[model samples]
Target: MADLLDQKVQAQSLVDVVAERLEAAIISGTLEPGSRLSEQALAASLGVSRGPLREAIRRLEGRKLLERTPNIGVRVAALSLRDLKEILEVREALEGMACALAAQNMSDEDIAALEGLIEAHGEQEAVREGKGYYQESKDFDFHFRIVTGAGNQRLEQMLLGDLYYLLRVYRYKSSTKPGRAKEALVEHQNIVAAIRNRDAGAAEGAMRVHLRNARRYVEEQLVEEGEAVVDPAPRKTGRVGSLR
Candidate 1:
C-alpha cells in the first residue's frame, strides 16, 4: 500500500513537471501556435517517458492550449483575430470588476505587494529596453495579483485558471509592439495607485482603459499582418461611479 501511494505521488509529480515545461515553451513562443507537436520528439527532448509526456499533453489539451484531431495528431491551439477580440471583450468586463472588488477587499499589505510587483517589472531588462512587458506567468503578473486580491474563488477560477494562458500568449505578442511595454507599465502604476487609495470606481476605470488599449494594440497588429480586420471603436458602457 505504501509503495503504491509513493508510485502515484511520483507519477503525478512527473506529470506536473512535464506540464509546466510544455506550458512555458508554449507561452514563450518556443512552440508556435498551430505547429504540430511530435510526441516522440517532445519526450526525447524533455527526457521524460511517453506516459508522463502524454499525460501532460492531455492536461494542456483540456485547457484548450492544444488541439487534437482525428488522424492528424496534436498541435498547439491558435486563436484567430476574432477569437482574440471576443476574449478581450470578456476579459475587459471581468477583470475591470475584479479590480473594483480588489480595491474594496485587499488589505494594505496586499496593495503594497502589488506596488512592489510594478516596481520590479519596471526594472526588468526587456521593459527598460522597450522590447517587451515583464509578465512571464500568472505568478509574476500585475493583473494576476489584482484578480487574486479580489478574493472571489469563482472569478479566480475563470480568469486565472480558464483564460490566463490563452491571454498570456496574445498579451506577450501585443507587448512586443514598439513602446507598448513602457505605456503598459504606466497603466499598471495607475491601477496600483487607484487600488491603494481604495477607490473602487477609479480602479475599475483604470483596468478597463488598460485592457481596451491592449485590445486596440492587438487589432492593429493583426491588421498590419493582414490576418484580420477588427473594428476599432470602443463599446460604450455605464460607469461604475464611486463604489466607495
Candidate 2:
C-alpha cells in the first residue's frame, strides 16, 4: 500500500507527465466525472509504469478530483452541490482573507496589474459570450499573484493545491454555460474595485460575494446537466465555522 501510494511521486518526470495528462482528461470530459479508472488500461494508454500511474492517481485523489474505493479501485469523484458549498465555504474565508491582506499591502504597480487582469477577464468573456473560445488564463494570473504575494505561505500552499482541480472543473463547465463568461467578467470587476479601494472589510465582503456567485453558477450547471445534487444549508450569514 505504501509503495503504491509513493509510486508516482518517486520521480518528478513521471509525476509531472501523469498529472498533466490526467488533468487534461478530466477537463476535456474524456475521463468523465464518476467514471471508473482502470489502472492497467490507463497505464497502457499512457505508456507509463503502473507505479507512476498509481502515484498520479494518489495526487488526484488528494485534490478531491478522484476517489478511492475500498479494494474496488478508483473513479472520478462526483461534484455535488453539498460538496460545492462545503468547499466554497472554506475557499470564501481563505480568499476573503487573502484579498483583505492584498488590499492593505498592494502597491500601485500591483493595483495596475490587477486592473489589467480584470480588463482581460472582460475581454475573455466578451469573446466567449459570442460563442468563441473562453480564454480565462489572464484572470487566473490575478488570483495567483494575490495569493502568492499575500505573505502567507500556508495559505498559498492551500490555494495552489486547490487550483489544479478547480481550473480543470472551471474550464470544462464554464465552456458549457452560456452566460458564465460574461458573469465572470463582472464578478472580477467587483473584486478588483474593492481591492483598489483598499477597504479590507469591503474587499473581504466582495470576495465572498464573487465566490458565492461562482459557486452558485457552477452548481446550477451541474444540476441542470444531471451532474450534481443541490444541497442547501440554512442561511449561515453572520455565522462561520469549520468542517474538518
Candidate 3:
C-alpha cells in the first residue's frame, strides 16, 4: 500500500511538470495557435514517457488550451476574435467589481506592495523604451494580486484559473500595439490610486474604463486584420453581460 501511494505521487508530479512546460510554451507563442501536436515528437522533446505526456495533454484539453478532433490529433486551441471580444466584455465587468471589493478589503500594506510592483514594471527596459508592456508573468502578477485581494474565492478562481491562461496567449500580442503599453501603465496607476484611497466606486469606475478601452483596442485590431466583421447595429450599454 505504501509503495502504491508513492508511485501515484510520483506519477502526479511528473504530470504536473509536463503540464506546466506545455502551458508555458503555448502561452509564450512557442507553440502557435492551431498547431498540431505529435505525441511521439513531444514525448521525445520533453524526455517524458507517453503516459505522462498523454495525461498532460488531457489536462490542457480540459483547460480549453488544447482540442482533439475525431480523426485529427490534438492541436493548440485558437481563439476567434469574437471569443476574445466576449472575454474582454466579461472581464470588464468582473474585474471592475473585483477592484471595488479590493478597495474595501485589501490591507494598506497590500496596496503598497501593488504600487511597488507597478513601479518595478515601469523600470523595465521594454516599458522604458516604449517597445512593450510587462511580460506575461509580470502583467498577470498585477491583476492576480488585485483579484486575490478581492477576498472572494469563487471570483478569484474564475479569473485566475483557465480563463487567465487563455488570456495570456493573446496578452503578449495586445500589449505590443503602438502606445498601448504606456497607456496601460497609466491605467494601472489610476486603478492603484483609487484602491489606495479606499474609494470603491472610483476603483470600480476606473477599472471599467480601463477594460473598456482595452476592448475597443482589440476590436480595432480585429477590424483592421479582417478577423471579425462588425455589426452595423447600435451598441447597447447597461450592466455587464454574463459569460454564459
Q: Write the per-residue lDDT of candidate 3 for residues 1-244, one digit (tens) a residue.
A: 1111112223448988788777767765557566677787677566668898899999999987888876667777766777788888999899999999999999999999999998988987777776666444533478888999999998987888777876776665456578887888899999999999999999999989888877787577656755453442222322111101
Measure candidate 1: CA RMSD.
11.4
Candidate 1 stretches greater than 4 Å from native: 1-13, 226-244
* Candidate 3 displacement at residue 145 in angstroms: 1.5
- Residue-wise lDDT of candidate 2 within 57-99, one digit each (tens)? 8988887777776755577655556766677778879988988
What's each prediction's TM-score? 0.81, 0.67, 0.74
Score candidate 2 by lDDT. 0.65
Where does model 3 exceed 4 Å of error?
1-18, 41-52, 134-140, 223-244
Question: In order, what is each prediction's RMSD in angstroms?
Answer: 11.4, 9.7, 10.3
For TM-score, candidate 2 versus 3, the one ahead is 3
Best by TM-score: 1
Model 1 lDDT on a 0 to 1 scale = 0.77
Q: Which ten residues in a row have the lowest lDDT in candidate 1?
A: 235-244
